[model samples]
Target: MSTKKHKVLVANRGEIAIRIIQACVSLGLDFVCVYTRADEASGHLALARSLGGPNAAYRVSSYHDANEILAVADHAGATAVHPGYGFFAEDFRFARRVAERERSLIFIGPSWRIIRSLGDKINTKRLARSLSIPTVPGSDRPVYDELEAEEIAETLFAFQAEQGISNSVVLVKASAGGGGMGIEEIYDIEQFKTVYRRIRNYAKRQFHDEGVLIEQRIFDFNHLEVQIVADRTGTGIVHFGTRNCTIQSTGRQKRVEIAPGFRPQEVDYAFDAEKLMEDIVGYSLAMAREVGYDNVGTWEWIVSPTGQPFLMEVNTRIQVENGVSAAISRVRGQGGVNIIAEQIRLGLGEPMGYDQSNITFDGVGIEYRIIAEDPANRFTPWVGRIDQFLAPTLPYASLHTHIPMDEPYEIPTEYDPNLALAIVWGKDLAEAKKRGVDYLDELTLSGADGTGTELKSNVRFLRDKTSTILQF
Candidate 1:
């Protein structure tokens, strides 16, 4: 276990790349950023060069090409690689490759064995059951074909009848899928038969795996997740609290709030706040220990209307909304722990710096994911050259984006449409939401004026109070 981090390569793009670069700088480690030709002019690459000097950036044919990234890492003598939340972040093979590389390049995430186990939804649920953690009732095995899906659906319906639950729906999900893709909601037997094949085909095409799992869909439930960090020694600490990710559209998160379940007055929820939090944290830590999970991860769950929490899945990488938890942790005076830095340290076999007692959650933090898409046109990607881009300088708000303000910026058509993330903290949720929307309003991104072709974003959507309101 060495504390020294010589050089690290960030194997992702967008704000997360910039985030890891900043963390590297904070830790006084040499940082390298790999980019596709499409991202040659990305703000993340520019920032990396600015922070790490001339030799900080490299270009690859594609970000998803692991061989090219590893070649560059070898060429640059990188000791570690950080897959920042997407692409190969959860790829067990990639993690194993990095670990077994001749140079001994460390992958800043959980062990490959743990990633392989938890990456499969079916295995994750099975492990949860083994640990006595509550899970949503669903198919016990992979639903490969229509017959298996039909059988599972029948079993689910029978169980629903036994439990006296009517109008229940089942979620057909890809066992190896992520980011809310390759999932279909089946309402009845007919729908199950129709969607089962489609979901398997989708899973095959998207994730390269045809394995699917069915879970009882809990409607009108709150999406909550706990952030936890673990070390090789089995020492772990869950974050100060939970994040409410219920504010979503089309199964994707639009906004996330920390301590979301703290407001017991506004929403009539049946769960005991103390016990629920304990369960979430307890289950997450216990699972991490079971798998020898080292580094940062998130445990996501759905809280039913009756206050029962069902384990959904585990994310073996940093989450998109982790900034809200970081903001809250900083306000609690815990020395503003940098999760990425901690991740690198943990990968280097360093022990966790803090424990549960040291972690604290204070105030409210909210994050709005600002995507460069036309909401009026069904969220179509608004790709163009940015003539001017300006973000607010609010004290309580932090903007994470790779959209450059200086010079012309071209929005690549090859990647996610997410342009930026605006995170704000306040004394309470109301103020956090208000300031978050205000900060979003202050942002401006447009094509050159008089071109009569301006790029549209979802700023207005973030300001909609009705959309921000939480539903139990």
Candidate 2:
């Protein structure tokens, strides 16, 4: 509650920008937001004008342009920069520049050093292994040598073979590239060298870094995440439970997320779901402490059919599903947990006046990412103006979105067609699942593309998966 003098520069757009502005309002912090010409109709800009100062919204040429954002911050006299999840959220170089610039501004996430250290997949693997944490068997660092990369790939195939995996697979990805780019999978050891050289060449051309990471490709696994929070001191580490992110798109993008990772009560899982959650949380905290991670971050993991867990990577910023985790969590038995606000407070050198013992988890929370897209058609985006968007208001449901309900809005093609996030919670998984379906059924979202085709959204896809959300 001490950030009255601090002003925040919201460096992203859409629903995330709206959420950050709301968090700033709740924290009594001044804020400014920027948007390109394409996002002129975004609700975040309107919200800023209504709640913030006269100069709350600024028109920038691009959101990815760091100089544009910093210039706006200086012009607005903002003291901190909040990169809401995307854009510069995980860019350590941007964070470093924000702090090291002549008119230094606070980067509202982990410190620049921590971001740089954990942003690299190769370095994160090494760091996890150094702490005796479980990670997929792979090269801890980049394999620049072709012979060494092949050795690692061979070892991975043998490891998979040892695990009784019939179709052994190895994944070769550029250590520097992210978001599933510069990666390929090989089923045959004979083809390993071929794929390795190809990816290495691509990595050099794309990222200017020839360092390649060859690892055992994990398939048929449940994606889970442990949310970690800490203060600037790095010792006030605590977890916001776990969530099951298994149900994803054909491209492996999460669409529905439910808190309390595995529902042992609802499904007969092979692994002790509760204990596994605790173990992963402990491992995540250990790693966070090991690297002095000093803000909100996610420890992403993959749980195999047998319940074996492996550290996937670290997201050094607040994720889109963070509100789902907060929905199921309570601080000192009270429920309004806003993690984005916590990230801002902590990033500005605020104290975590409470610890893990003060926190408790209750009820099951679910979040459905509402997008103007067709799930059946490989989750292809639907671009057009939305004439109807009706968000239901329920006591147990919370909707976070940048799309306006009172007016028709155009679905911008410049960004992902993600329209909104519907979050609901209930006493248990059964009730939560029911409420989720009800929300989807009652909601109305329609739009049309240039061809005058009817709107196609993932509402049907989200409802269809509600029946199997937390089932192990």
Candidate 3:
């Protein structure tokens, strides 16, 4: 294949946009970036302008809807559309529109139909069960009333005949929700009824979708995940190792995230988690094969103390930690600089040499999502000009910092609070933790005293160390 330059239009904003622009530059492709009026002076737009020459950068006049973004892609004459990990990235309808709008405007992800299938919680649970994937015990469909929930519980009991679950604690989750919303635990059927009603009302008021899901709750578990990449050519699959995210202590207090969260807290039960990762990767590969999933995706799972890992959900596009995944993919020589590069190549009809021999380096990699939140006030989002900023340092490892050195960084109230990502690779888990700690300690954010540690207790470092110095 000739290495001809292709113009890529990123359909999102923020640090991820800059990351995609860099990837385009690395692969000798022109980048066309679009942003709202609010983001005209944002770091992402600034970086995009700096990367591409005149007439290559495109800025939209207004923020209408997903279709407006797609229209920008069409006007720019972009060969491919990358949704970047938020907004319409996982929206199946949006993907279908991109596919049908233009032949060359590849969606850069799994097909629209497959995305919609997995988009619904009910359908996803069914698919997981059929593939022998361990999913949280939940209602088969949306429960509209208390009696229907009871009936669903009876069916769940029948399904749980082999396992001993007498006092079942359930969680009411939304059928079409994510980002930690629409999930509440219930200790009794009455509580489940109440929580379900609350969730249903919230969903109706917010999403205009009154769908509710009930599932058994797993307590004191480690939030773990596995990432998988596949293609339509039936080339084998790739697993980008695993990550341990056990530091989400979101009760009434705030805490700093330490690697290994709590030493020996789950050491006696980690084997079960390893097995769960294997199963998750296997299930993801099977699902991809079943529906012809191409490009990159991830399967998330939660592991209990008993070593049982249950699939939580799946993300259909590049994730917040795409930097780490991209590094792994590149070290293995599987694709270009980023997952989008690989997706573009696959969409343009290129051969995928999915060889294990291509993947290199077996070190530990970890990412810390630096958000603009105040720990004292329940981790509320901090928005303003970043008057001062200093990135952390990494030793004995490769460091990838996403924040630009511009005098002012934009923090808007219309979106997520994740400001930047600090990805580091170390010789071992403990060493990786040390590097992470040292790196976090050097961050000097302005419009604030130092790093907000309210959510420090919820911060996970993925190491076995109990305590580490992180003085910023």
Candidate 4:
């Protein structure tokens, strides 16, 4: 690990790219940005230009092209590369390529060896079992063909029948997928072959992996995740404060809240929250140590109605809802450790600056992902130029976006469905909900009038009172 200030290359775009640029500026480090041709005039590129110094920006055909991104990094003399959130953030091959580089460029996330071991869902579950961590019952190996899928389905059905249980739904998920993609639900055992084939095809096309993993889908469960940060020396801290992401409809996160309020009147599940948090933190750290994980990562779990917490998966990159955790730490007087800065320092062989005792959750935090889609029209893609964009200005509230304020605000053509993120912290869950709703009400994005615009946003949906309530 080199102790010198590094020149980092941002290999992704959108709000995350802008966030990394800000982190670089704060650390007094040089950074270069790569963008697609469609984003030549995007707000993120403009931001890089405005913060010009040793920073350089390049245009590539695709953000997923590892070779082209490395070429630009090499030409710009970047000492490190940051793959923010999506795209190549968890790409083991990309990490390996960076590590194998002749010029010695650092990959800001986990080591390639660790990524290769845990990137596969099946392998990760097996690792959890080896470590005595509870996991959802499912196939212990990858399902490569329809026969294997049918066998696993029969096995699960027999097991459920032996236990005298009905409504046992199983999920066929891609072994190498992330961001809630490459998953299909199988409610009936007879439908396993067809659904498995479809899922495998989808997985191959999308994730470039035909291998699939089967898991017992627990209904009426809550989705929770624990955030963890570690260094090469094995020092780590688990932000025990959990987040409730159970308000999703189609397995996609619409809204997320930290320190989820569990009303006894709402659900039947009963457990000691403190004990659960301690167990989760211990399990996550044990797994991280097993894999030699360094940098920031998340451990996701699905808690059943019976209060049984099962490991779902592990995210090897910074999550989209990171602002909520940061706000919670900041309000708790923990100085809101900058996760990106820690990643850089860990890659440079520095010990974790803080320990577990330094972490304290003081308040409630919530985050809403404002995507450019029509909720009434099956969440169809809505893309257009913005004539006006106004976000709310509130204390303890943060907005991460690249939407510009000019005569004509145009969104890039080649990008994901996300538009922006609004994160707010409050004294408690109720106050957080109120602040979040107010912020959403103040957010405005409209296209040019009389332009026959089909563009829409979820701002109205997020502002609705029902949006704040947790629903399974």
- Which candidate wins on lDDT? 2
Off by more than 4 A, model 3:
1-3, 61-64, 102-104, 144-147, 150-168, 249-276, 326-337, 393-404, 448-472
Model 2 RMSD, rounded to 1 decimal: 2.2
199-317 per-residue lDDT for model 1 (tens digits):
88888888788888887878788788888777767555445467778776565544445555445544444667657767787887788878877778888998887778899888988
- Ranking of all predicted structures according to lDDT, beginning with the best and ending with the worst: 2, 1, 4, 3
Q: Across residues 40-106, which tens digit of lDDT does each residue of candidate 2 receive? A: 8999988988897568899999998998999899999999999988789889999999999998999
Q: Across residues 180-246, which tens digit of lDDT does each residue of candidate 4 receive? A: 6777888788888888888898888987878888877777887788777777665554454566666
RMSD of each: 2.5, 2.2, 5.0, 2.7
| Pairs with steric clashes in candidate 4 | none
TM-score of each: 0.93, 0.94, 0.83, 0.92
**Backbone collision tally, model 1:** 0
Worst 10 residues of 4 by lDDT: 260-269
Clashing pairs in 1: none
Stretches of model 4 off by over 4 angstroms after superposition: 1-4, 53-55, 236-240, 249-251, 257-269, 330-334, 448-454, 465-472
Better of 1 and 3 by TM-score: 1
Better of 1 and 4 by lDDT: 1
lDDT of each: 0.78, 0.90, 0.62, 0.75
